[model samples]
Target chain A: MEDTGTRSFVERLLQLDRRWIFLGIALAVVVPFLVPGFKMRSGVVSPRTQSIYDTINGLPAQSVVMFAFDYGPASIPEMQPMAVALCKHAMSRDLRVIGVAIHPQGPLLGGQALREAAEEYGKQDGVDYVNLGYKPGGAAAIKGIGTNIYKVFPTDLSGRNSATLAVMQGVRTYDNIDFIVALSSTPAPFSWIAFAHEAYGAKMGVGVTAVMATDFYPYLQTDQIVGLINGLKGAAEYEDLIRHPSYGMLGMSAQSVAHLWIILTVIIGNIAFFMWRARTRG
Target chain B: MEPGEAVATGMYYLSGPVIGTGVAVLLTLAIYSFLYADNPVYKFAEHLFVGVSAAYGVAITYHMAVLPLIIDPLFRPQNTPSGQPQYWVIIPALLGLMMFSRFFRRYDWMSRWPIAFMMGIGAGLAIPATVQTSLLPHLYSTMQPLAPMAEGRLDLLTGIDNLLLLVGVVCVLIYFYFSLEHKGVFGVASRVGIWFLMIAFGAGFGNTVMARISLLIGRVQFLRFDVPEIFFPPSP
Candidate 1:
């Protein structure tokens, strides 16, 4: 009779200490950042990131744009730069920006972006941009904006009423609001498009984590959403689109090396599997 | 620094003898300890992540939901024409409040409306967007020719890609549709569909691993580059 167990080598391979795998993954990442030599030439810009640029770029000077800071600190590395770049670009164009957050911390993050960008572009706080901070309603807040933008966001980051400002006067609803850019780690962007865009035909933009991109592609294809900045890759793509370089590129180069490591590991694992299989079969 | 700002970031920089190495090594070991067996250290970190995230979520909801709706319209109203209440919204708002009462067990059913609304709306938003964003565009994108497109003419490469995508997608769709039995052409089609699914999964896995590795790189950059001030100051 043929030996049935055959040392159950594949099982042992399967049972191989997972700690080693974790360590390998850790090193696979850690080594790349410590040293330098990796570089990235701008690959072809995906249409997704470009449309966002074009949409923001195309708007007239002092166009009123509302952007959300929806992610937390963990997501800052991937998301904050896109928010900053877009804020900087918009402020540079003299776009009147309204910073809001579905996330509570959004006011802080969004305020910081507007302030930094304002300083860089020499924009006045109330004149160039306004940080609406965090609002009360979830999706309902978005729907409310269809009727009254001021009612939804009555105050700035501070307690001051929005009606007191020049920026808030003509902006009644989503109709007057030139563009809606939502930066979310969660599902906020989709809701904004659904509630506000569907209800009021607000021009919509979304920047989200990459894993969510596959889900958003249908919206992109339908032309319901004008642009997408997905994951860090999408952020990197956006950085390329802006002609300003930052962390996205560093992340990309590290990512490229790590990818190559995994590919090699897979190849080696496959070879070992095939060899073990053939010996047992013989 | 502001009152809310966290300066420590859990990092304690010190001179000589790998002072942080104790914690760094312990944390690394603790995180990795989950693989060998589940223990207190692993549990601690996991709980810490969950607790911090939950606190953030609760705080956000307080501002984003409670303060704005129940607190604002009821007590503190701003930006009103006459400083009066938008009292009509209180009905649905009350219904929304009934949701948190689920923890009381007896009042659990009240939460159904809010939960159902969330689910129903999420599904509602997702379904239409899915068709508009994912299904149609992917169908169009995949139809491109494997080679190149002719200028001012029908893009040949697109057409070829379209053919492959069409065949693959249709077969994959058929695999899910249990209206008919798997037989003859259907069996073959479903098998071919598996191949397309496998290829897609492989690519997804590759990209996903790359993404995860990048996240790990960020953590490492913090450890080696950010923490070690004795060796290096901030890169400027």
Candidate 2:
């Protein structure tokens, strides 16, 4: 009778409503914030993230570093933190930052990051940094920038002449750029690697969403990109390196709890499946 | 100053950010309602999001690409550095306009010209660069010396990693080779390849989960902290 009861319980678990899982996820995410003095240590920085920090840190003051914003609002949570962190790091290092975008929504998102970081650092517009903004073609536009930046971005995002901007002063092409970092939720990094890195030998790195991170390992290993920042954990690692904890660090506790919830569910679901299968076979 | 009056004054000062935050919170909650069950609220939010995104795309394209690249260059020649019309802009603009021909059945074939031009140019530019950046470098990295020497002596760990990588790559490649039958030694290699592929897939899936959880955490943070903060500013 006990054996039959145990079997039925497992079967019931197997048939558990998915809404329960959703509620569990919500609780897991919420409880961390509610708990008093709860904080998860932003763990040891990964070498891949370290490589990005080191690359930026190693650059000389006033070196031109271009950031390609190639993501949309859907990716704001994952992509924006990296952009802000990177922008802050670059500005702190006194590097001349130039922003560009291949995605339509990238300009606005990139501009927001730049504005936030600039405000923190008290950096001036046009003189310290400039937003070249979005262009239509992806790989082709990147190639055009490699040839003549003035021709591709004749005017800045605000309709100011590119030639008149202080940041654009000697930045004619990839030859002038010290480094390029493409923050993307799309395959824009590959386009940069092809046109900017391979074609013109522009040194580059990439910050990508976690799902796309695995796809770029081969490139990272081959030194096609100087470094790779993989999603939010990567953003946290970067925040730690820069000694300024923001959204990335704040989200770690909730992220950990939610992940634990997922793992627990997966284990239970698997156990229930196996038990049900054995019962059916018997 | 009275406390209620101070609160009212603060709200007036922060009206813009507060109203924006309220709308964001509503939309977020409406979207999350789908978790309970697909309802009108969720459907309304979803449709609103889609419509807004489409409109934003069109507006951005015009401001970023059309106005500056085509209209300004051709019409307002004074805006150009040379202070003369860029005739070259007309060619690309005409090609871009040809894209709209697909909307009309009779002239739909004209769309092929721009498509072919783009494909031809893209392939011509990408093939050589892809080979140099992706294919060759990957091959070179894979062809590492198994017994790598660091300083003077052989690095055992490095050698082991290189060997494992080599074996994994070879096995995976063999698994994709379908000309021969899966029997004898080939079958064993293919099975090993399957294990490697599964491990890769597992890692990819884990990363994907992490990405989704991070997004959820972001929204949750906004609701938990940002919303309240917008209404009640912390004293300096």
Candidate 3:
């Protein structure tokens, strides 16, 4: 009977090797990058990335901005694009940037972003930017920085006295910072909101991984954070807002393709399941 | 090599693109072999990653934290203007040293003091801030205009959104209210709350999927574009 044939087909579909799906995903991602003249159009700008852009754009030239690269190598794929976009935007505005990290790999990643931006803008390291580097202790160190940065970060990443850096001449604590942006993969942003933002009344912005994005929505509504950029979509939106198409924008096309593939797989799976159920009922 | 570059002249070869890209590609492929089956290649890559991260973490902790926070400050002349030592840092220094007592079976109880002190301070610091920033503000935001008036006039779309949000919040809260029995209208409302919860969870899952795919795309791009450009630069 047709019912038996249909049931067998559905069963086979259900039992298909998962490796095939993995291969599908691989193709979905790789084809976009390898294709000649493949240009990915920028995605629609979300309000979060827009807010981040507006906040940075509205800042005065030479304003001191603090960027906390609170992430590691594992998070580089997601967080790095946002960092690059932020550094580029801040540097373009002639803003003086002070970079720090609570996580060990943060300083290295932060330094990479600053160096890339600085080179593009022909900006001097000591004068235009300084990387204070990784300080141990999570929330406590954040509180310490807000209170007395000199005591917390005695020296910069390269062992130069932090006080000697031209960028750090008058900038001491959170009060001196115009804006504090925490680019994080963990709960460090919430710690910033709790310790630094609450105590010092520091204007905070956050760029968190997508998985952690929705949990911070309440803070955004409450105006506890001025701006938020979540995941690669946020990074792409930021790059689009800044009118510079970079890595984030470039990756969007492949992301779209992969999403479509996943959605299709889900739809097929549901249909097969329902078909199998109908056959059993008969 | 440039004189002012971060890499030392003797170790310049270590920073070359070939070694970096080769290692990256090999490790990525090895990890991706898990899609086929669990094998020694994947396990080797996994163990290597764990080992390197642990080693790096220890080195960074000592260099960044212990050197500056404890060793340098206590030894540096400027920290103690007079010949006498600055005893202020000694309190924290002693507490930090106590944390290492966990290594010895007999002395493990001593480590509890530092752990307790840290937790106590952390709780004391976080509670007030959480209440002010997270709790109160969240409650305030959730209590938005139920009718969603725009410019002293009623707007249909805004009103619908506000009404849905209000209903969702109320229903969800009601569902969690243990005092109320699941009977009559309460049961219906709780059922509706389940739908709203499902929708929120679905949204979160969608976002999670998007994030994962983004990561996959990044790795593929690295293999395709990043490594090629680094190892085999196009002629000018």
Candidate 4:
């Protein structure tokens, strides 16, 4: 007779309905979003993240900061929160914000954020901050910003010339830039540390996709980036640090349930694996 | 609205057709279901994602890298609204063009100039910064309070984490070092190093899953609200 049991095992393995798993994962994540615990469980916070916060927190009012939005729509929720937080913190501290977008969609993405955050902070546009929309060339854009921020983009996203804006007066290049923060999904402007910090001298900070975080930690430890927030987890921690219960925290409460669910799945899967192996050996 | 705005508005309408939203939501959920096991829906979504990402990559490069920087600047020099190039733009443009030659088998050798420039700058960046950013500060930071600081320098947490990190760094470095064959104490260290690497990889795996899941959640939100009136009725 044909080995029916082995065939069945193979068939199950081949034809398993992934929708059930998706349903579980959906429940795991969505449930957490619905009922946010805001549970601040203690975990390792890399020194890189700590320094970034400290660097910004220490800045004085009217300190012109070049904030680069190098990420796109794919990175909206994860990176935007930190970007918004940085803007809020910047405006709250009275820092002059000069926003530049390297991605075409970035200015619009970051502009909407800057607008909402500004409304909350009671900040004016040209007087407090200005958006110098997207530029072409990856490192060349960095090169331009390093030399002259105003030269790169003459007009703000609102079509106001940089020369006319009072906020743009003192700001020009890496020298004028007190702090540079960027949020990237795919190590956007990955060369900032190499080109911006190393070639020139600009104190840098970043919010990168978590996968890229480890690659950067060596740099973070070396102090290339004054602060390094890796992925959503880092964003959540920074949210915690600022005491702002924005999307990061709410997302975290949602994320934790999913994380727990994943852990349980792994545990169960492992047990099943062992049981199968034992049965086979028997 | 201007002619350009009118055209863009038309394109926007064309991009996401009425049925597009519903299909996108179901496919997204289906794609996410792959965590359970391999299924047709998940496969369909995965294929779609792959296709979409590849198209996005091509479009981004064309729109962002080639057109605005290269084609418009050179071919339509007179129409260049941003003023004079003064030869500086030409070098970067030529170098970027050289990078495309790398895709051609017969002409691949021509690509080296740009590749060399990239490598030279990359090498220039790695040495000093790598030492300053990766090595020294990491060594320094690892000296933290596993608990609290002692009077002089209490590195309980910092010391241990740093040590783990350092060992991982050294061992992983050795694995790729390849100067000599793996054997004896060195082999043992490399083996231990691999375990650390695996753990790091595991953490990486978890992070990736989390990111993809987040992206999925976003599409679902778009669908549930945007599509043919699902459970959620448009956020107020």
Per lDDT, the best of the predicted structures is: 2
CAPRI rating of model 4: incorrect
Candidate 2: segments with Cα more than 4 A from true spot: B1-16, B234-236
How well is each residue in B40-116 modelled by candidate 4, as lDDT tens digits?
88888888888987897677667645654566566755434454454566888788788889789999998999989
Q: How many Å off is the CA of A217 in candidate 2?
A: 0.7
A92 Cα displacement, candidate 2 (Å): 1.0
TM-score of chain A of each: 0.89, 0.98, 0.97, 0.88
Off by over 4 Å in 4: A1-19, A33-50, A154-160, A241-244, A278-282, B1-166, B177-181, B220-236
> What is the C-alpha lDDT profile of model 2 across A1-282, one tens digit per residue?
998999989988988999999999999989998998788776788989999999999999999999999999888778888999999999999999999999989999999999999999999989999998998889889999888998888888887889889988999999999999999999999999989998899999999999899989999898889999999999988988999988888788888888889999999999889888988899
Ranking by lDDT: 2, 3, 1, 4
Candidate order by TM-score, highest to lowest?
2, 3, 1, 4
> With candidate 4 superimposed using the best TM-score fit, by how many Å does residue B211's alpha carbon deviate from the native?
2.1
TM-score of chain A of 3: 0.97
lDDT, model 4, position B112: 92
Among the numbered candidates, top TM-score falls to 2
Per-residue lDDT for B1-236 in model 2, tens only? 55456566674444677788989999999999999999999999999999998998898899888887888789987766667788898998999899999999999999999999999988987788788878899999999889999999999999999998999999899899999987889989998999999999999999999999888888988998888887676653
Q: Which runs of model 1 end up more than 4 angstroms from their true locations?
A: A1-16, A36-42, B1-38, B78-82, B85-93, B105-154, B224-236
- Candidate 2 chain A has its poorest 10 consecutive residues by lDDT at A36-45
Candidate scoring better on TM-score of 1 and 2: 2
- Root-mean-square deviation of every model: 5.7, 2.4, 3.4, 6.5
Error of 3 at B81 (Å): 12
